[model samples]
Target: MPITGTTRVFLIAGDPVAQVRAPEIYNHLFERHGIDAVLVPVKVPPARLADFVRNAFGAENVGGMWVTIPHKAAMMALMDRCDPVAQLAGAVNAVRRADDGAIEGALFDGIGFVKGLDHFGIPLEGRRVLVIGAGGGGQAVAAALALRGVGELAIYNRSTDRAADLCARLAAASGGVTKVAASPDPAGYDLIVNCTSQGLKQDDPLPFDPKRVDAGAAVEDIIMTREPTPLLKACAELGISAHAGFEMLVQQIPEYLRFFGMPELARTLQDDTSEVRALLYPK
Candidate 1:
């Protein structure tokens, strides 16, 4: 897959794009699969997101865009239509223009998070879960969890109102089947997921006390840094099973491929993502 005039270009936009790992992961997949596609990262400030998106989509060769960080929530308004999950989560991480020039949007963070849990054999059905964050990522993860038949879902955010709002939305979407509420308490939960940026900094304190997590409970931090976050370290010390965000990210590759109209490639990758996982997190 040499870069050529016919290459399908995909842009991933964020204010600080240097930290993004999508280009490396997706480019490797495209090249290895003999697909004429390229994913590029672009630094677009929040104020210029709309303009940047409009101008980028004007180019005929542009296939789609990947939204990150501050852009996910804002990207929702830019879509002609959004997937139900995106609407429920109030965010969109992937966007593409249809043959009719309609902009379609979707959020894969939550879906990927749940799938990653499955990949690690962490059961979710009928399990009590606590999500510590209510931002875009948190909302997406919580929304997905509620729909996954979790026995109970609790959200904890610095802003109680935000967490409460997300819980309400999730409860309504689940037809009252999911017992969701806003609470920072992690005790008694079967699984705890950290969806906050607290773990991004080395010195940042653990999102929640691992000692408070129940015995045999598992924890997952959605922070994708190579170094283990403090939360992971604390869980390890407590003899609790903990995981990094690598699997969650690795799991999203196929979803993005399918959203971008590469269904065949998506299916192929879904059947076996070990190669991608190894590339991202080598043992």
Candidate 2:
């Protein structure tokens, strides 16, 4: 429902809010749909997220929020209830404020990435997927894929313990089909998903040797800013199909809109891709 007075406000909150593209993309969508809504970025320190959300809830215009980075796990504690994916992933990346002022949280990154893969016409069912980095993002992606009935999932992290824990969790959830293991062998896998922060900075070594990557496999990097991270560039040179983080960003918005009780607006806005691309990949 639209707000009674003025505009409905949405926010994406994280430590480093200046770099976020959500406001641009979402505001454009709001404009296109003729909704009295505006999306903004909010910079909240890790310790202040709970307070911020509490205060924001009192404001009648505030509708929803997007949480990112270090806060995805922390934000779950502030919500009234979490969606199934958020509960399983142990994190929340989006939150919606209901008419009663209750907050509902959900994790969209994993599902969004799979939606991106689908957008590119890539199939995950029965395909062997190699996921590097067993961090929050990796765990979310692995769980999402397993839920989609992927044939095999091999997860690797620098810390073997983390990988083992994540693997065990996924295996239990997947009914023993998802396999978690160490090593960057890209061979025999249909998809390679990078969920680490390694590519966010320059001069970072390739997480794994590019030569070992299967030439026929598709590569997906969750880092959004740099279009061609070293790993993606390597995959490209080797004739591999690759997807960047923008695809995930684009795929996530619709789910977020629905969580905020605006499914029609979400569907209407998603029909246009040019505006989203322009916001995400501004020159």
Candidate 2: C-alpha lDDT: 0.81
Write the residue-wise lDDT of candidate 2 on 1-283 in tens digits.
Answer: 2444788888888998877767777777677777788888889998888899878878877888888777898998889998767876778998887667678899998888888898999998888888999888898888788678788888888888888887787786665766666587677788888888888876788877767766577888888765578878877778878878788877787888888778887776478656666766777
- The local distance difference test score of each candidate is 0.87, 0.81
lDDT of 1 by residue, 11-32 (tens): 9998899988889989998999
TM-score (C-alpha, index-matched) for candidate 2: 0.90
- Estimate the TM-score of every prediction: 0.92, 0.90
Q: List the residue pairs that clash in candidate 1.
A: none
